[model samples]
Target: MLMSPTVRSGTLVMLIALLRSPATTVAVPPPSSVQASAIGADVTAGKHLFERHCAVCHGIEGKGGRGPGLNRAQLAHAPDDTALKSVISDGISPDMPAGWFLTDEDVANLAAYVRSFSNIPSEPLPGDAVRGAGVYAKGGCSNCHIVAGAGFGYGPELSNIGIRRSAPYIRKAIVKPGATMPEGFLLVEAITPSGDKIEGIRVNEDTFSIQIKDATGQFHSLRKQDLKELQKLRGESPMPSYGGVFNTSELDDLVAYLASLRGKQ
Candidate 1:
């Protein structure tokens, strides 16, 4: 669900404090202690599990790349254990590889690491509708995500995002992208003989030239003929899927804030 961007400024301080607490690991378990069980899982150990098995794809802290960021607020609010384990074991469709490689114990460790980023409470953020309006303007969300009849032209419009998406799902999309990245939004790069380089959203391409649209809506027509090199990659987005980027509460506020954006202005 898209969360409301409007948080009361007063609530922000309290939410931040709560987010930093050790007990904040809600919906998900506390960081499991590796010594607690023969399973030997803890956030630290889970970090190792992530690096050895997951980092190459998911990134060191699950900020996402070839994989998706795991540190999403949505995962915190969703159904527990069963849903998580299933995804871990079965994997997200298409992009994510199945987690059959992981032992159940290892999966648990991984879950802990992923869950460590959540606020762990059933309560939604104390968002202020009035404040959210300002956030929407300040956060530069319109630069990528369009909402209602306004905003930028780069990303999928959020006209009815609150209706179509859930809070957790929205959060996941922000932090971890590769798992269900919408196609056609792939970034492309080209290098010219003059040593000029360019990159943007791939619009259209052939043997001769490719088209790309940058954030500002400027289109660059890159000539394949004069290009010294051309490269296309499928990986994490330049958009920092905020894993470590946003605190759990800020994410919650953002989500709540976006959710509120549904309907008329």
Candidate 2:
């Protein structure tokens, strides 16, 4: 059951206080202790249990569905195995509920299973970044995407995209731009009373008002009541897909160049 707003506020206040209480807070449990506890724990049993219980939100492989992927970087909340074990047992408020029904050994087993996916993996690209830069320029990639301030202030900045996203993800984004529209970049078509239609990617929105930036780099601010029609297009980007634009080798070169862009222009 969800907590009432009043109860939630009080709980949040208490949590903040506890987080700030250096003297009252207990020491972080050691990863070694968690490992020792799970030395004889059945990982296969844990996987089965996880699929039955946690797979809906977190994928069967812990790759994330409704929740963040477990197979990524170190978890921000639970930095170590000891902390993770506690989180699994107690759970976080609001989003995660306490696992009071789970036995200590069961929680330990889950923790062990979860721990196995924390390794970060990277694939090496075969194409040359130098040649890829030329292809990027020819394809007018910089017109919308900014790499070290080379392009217009439209679309997503790609200066540090190499560090932010994986190579495979980048390739998918290029081939299918509208497949997964990014957050805060949802395409919206707003029509005014006099049959004036404004199509743009939303910048910000609230219950009362919305702000959108058009392809022409113009920002439109309008009240909810003023708009005759407001449509939100999910999984849609303004950028055209490069599915047929680039050949097989050029695509590989472009991806390679993008992957090589750690931070430079």
Most lDDT-accurate candidate = 2
Cα lDDT computed for each candidate against the true fold: 0.61, 0.71
Model 1: per-residue Cα lDDT over 1-265, one tens digit each? 0111265644544654564466763633353332122122345556677788777665565655544345555542224655666777886644456789898878877766666544333344465545655656766677777776787867667675553445556667767765545545577777879887777678888888899777677898877888888888677465656666666656667767765555552
The worst-scoring run of ten residues by lDDT in candidate 1 lies at: 31-40
Alpha-carbon error at 129 in model 1, in Å? 5.7
Q: Going through the candidates in order, what is the number of backbone clashes in each? A: 20, 0
Please state the error at residue 135 of candidate 1 in Å. 3.9
Tens digits of per-residue lDDT, candidate 2, 1-265, equal 1112244655645644554467643542343633443444445567777897777656788765434456745665567767877887786643455678888778877886776666534345777788889899999988788898788756877786664445666788889987644444588999987878998878889999999888777999989898899999877788898989999889889988986675642
Evaluate residue 242 in candidate 2 and report its C-alpha lDDT on the 0 to 100 scale: 92
Off by over 4 Å in 2: 1-121
Top candidate by TM-score: 2
Show model 1 residue runs off by greater than 4 Å: 1-134, 177-180, 260-265
